[model samples]
Target: MQTNHDHSDVTVRRDGHIAIVELARPPYNYFDETLIGHLVAVFEQLDDDASCRAIVLASQGKAFCAGADFSGGPTDPQMPRRLYRHAVRLFATRKPIVAAVHGPAIGGGAGLALVADFRVTCEAARFAVNFNRLGIHPGFGLSVTLPRLVGPQQAAMLLFTGKRIDGRKAVEIGLADVLAPDGEVLAHAVALAHDIAASAPLALMSTRATLRQGLADAVLAAVDHEASEQEWQVRTADFAEGVAATAARREAVFTGK
Candidate 1:
């Protein structure tokens, strides 16, 4: 195994033909513009490495990613726009990604997970698209990717309700590919990456490219609309109440302002 030293928040290690990219933020791998940018850089570097045929995205901590930490200061309406731009770069990378969803992937965190080609999750893992619950439109190109993975109706249900589902339910609903045992999600994800890496590298890239053709473009367009909606929604009274309610750990009382 060879360790590729890079940015602080993200790290990459090589195991034969697969590159394991890990998020170093622990407990809750909350993302921001800088973390997303580092991820895009690492993924692009992996794309240029010929020996790296597949990538496994894993995170250290109790939760895979608990979403953005909007705890302090006034919410920056433009942050999502900037972060979404960085996210587009992630979708543009030309490498197979298998995400290890060992824990919670909520809100934008779930969007990050969807950037991968496949996801391996455990029964304890939780998946949710809670942007609507946050009183904002979905960002991170989830409008296109979620529907692409699970179809329009299922995507609508998940987006509109902002419901959290377990790994078994996620697999059943097509949100995740494989369901691994608790404590072995990363191992299974790496094994899946290895399986994908076994194929001819050029052929693998070609087939993946063909399959995901125009996906990045679709995400680009979707995020534009999503960001526009979010920009306005974030200014609403309901959004304010939603954030407060979440921080208080209670159901939100939305006034529909």
Candidate 2:
């Protein structure tokens, strides 16, 4: 195993042809611009490394990622715009990725997992797109990826209700590719990555590119529309109520004012 770069928010280590890229934040692993930037850098580096053919995107925290840190720190209105710029780069990466989702992946976090080529999850994992519940349009290119994975009808159900589903249900719905035992999510993800890595590297890249043709471009376009919707929604009275209610752990009573 070769240990390459270790940053504050992410760590990149290579085992044979599979690179294990782990998010370092503990507990919830709430994302910010710094974390996203670090991830983009790591993925880009691994793309160029001939020794790394595939990746397992895992997290150290209890939750794979609970989404953005909306607990109020930066007041910058352009923050999501900046974050999506980095996120789009993730979709452009050439190597296949398998995400190990052992816990909650909510809102944009669910979007992050979709960036992977496949997701390996356990029953303990929860996946949701809670943007509508927060009175905002979904971002992180989920507007495109989610529907592409699970069809528009199921995607609409998930987006509108913001309901969380367990890993087994996610697999049944095609949101996750593999269902693993509770503690073996990461191992299962790495095993999947290894399977991809064992293939002929050049052919694998070519085949993967052919399979995901235009996906990055579609995600880029979708994010533009998503950001525009979110901008207006952020100004709504219901947005504030949604965030507050979420923090308070209560059902949000949104008035479409």
Candidate 3:
């Protein structure tokens, strides 16, 4: 069965061993500064609780997240620092995070999907790393994670071109672990969480740790890369192009500044 939870712009429901964090911003769930703190707060709450071993991030919207809330103007100066802090916490949480991608996961939203321990996506889901299109450098450990997933070559193509891949392709490319019907991604992620929850907790946590040791370095390295890139972009003319296009809801034409 389903349960309803009401938070400011997010809803969190916990039942037995699993918790679901729903991005309830309709039409688009692109995170704002407040919502980012909400994300960190919910995850922190889950981290402290022994009963909640699994989390599924889902959304009730046309998009899983379009990226950071570009509609608000410029990116937060403190966001990179905060993003890295939260990423470190997520890595060390030991609890498994599962993402149920219902629609477009673009830019930082791509980072959110893969930030989870496991990911499931809808057949209609679209994934893109459009930081280049946005005239911003990547954040959320993408410099390290993208190369690990699609290899540096394919990752370069996607990052530079800002092209989107469908869920079927995402699964085939090893980006999505499971593919479900458009509205059925939450069910699949929940099922996966239940399966993980049924297993021995200590054993699962140990395995999760073993797999994440390498990521620790990557996370730090990505923070550096994203910082340098964003610092440079803040001084560029092309960044203006990206911001204008995004605000106008049109295509960005970056001149490679």
Q: Write the candidate numbers in order of decreasing TM-score.
A: 1, 2, 3
Candidate 1 per-residue C-alpha lDDT over 161-194 given as tens digits, one digit per residue, 9 for 90 to 100: 9999999999998999999999999999999999
TM-score, one value per model: 0.98, 0.97, 0.90
True-structure lDDT of candidate 3: 0.80
Question: What digit string (tens of lDDT, one per residue) describes model 3 on residues 133-227?
Answer: 87877887888877877789888988998899999998888888898987889999999999999988778878888987778667877777787
Report the lDDT of model 1 for residue 1.
98
Candidate 1 similarity to native, TM-score:
0.98
* Candidate 2, residue 152: how far the Cα is off, in Å: 0.5
Which residue window of length 10 is worst by lDDT in model 3? 84-93
| Alpha-carbon lDDT, every model | 0.92, 0.92, 0.80
lDDT of predicted model 1: 0.92
- Please report the TM-score between candidate 2 and the true structure: 0.97
lDDT of 2 by residue, 1-257 (tens): 87765697898888888999999898899998999999999999989999889999999879999999877722356778888989999999999999999999999999999999999999999999999998888999998999999999999999999999999999999999999999999988888899999999999999999999999999999988887887777878888888888989999998996
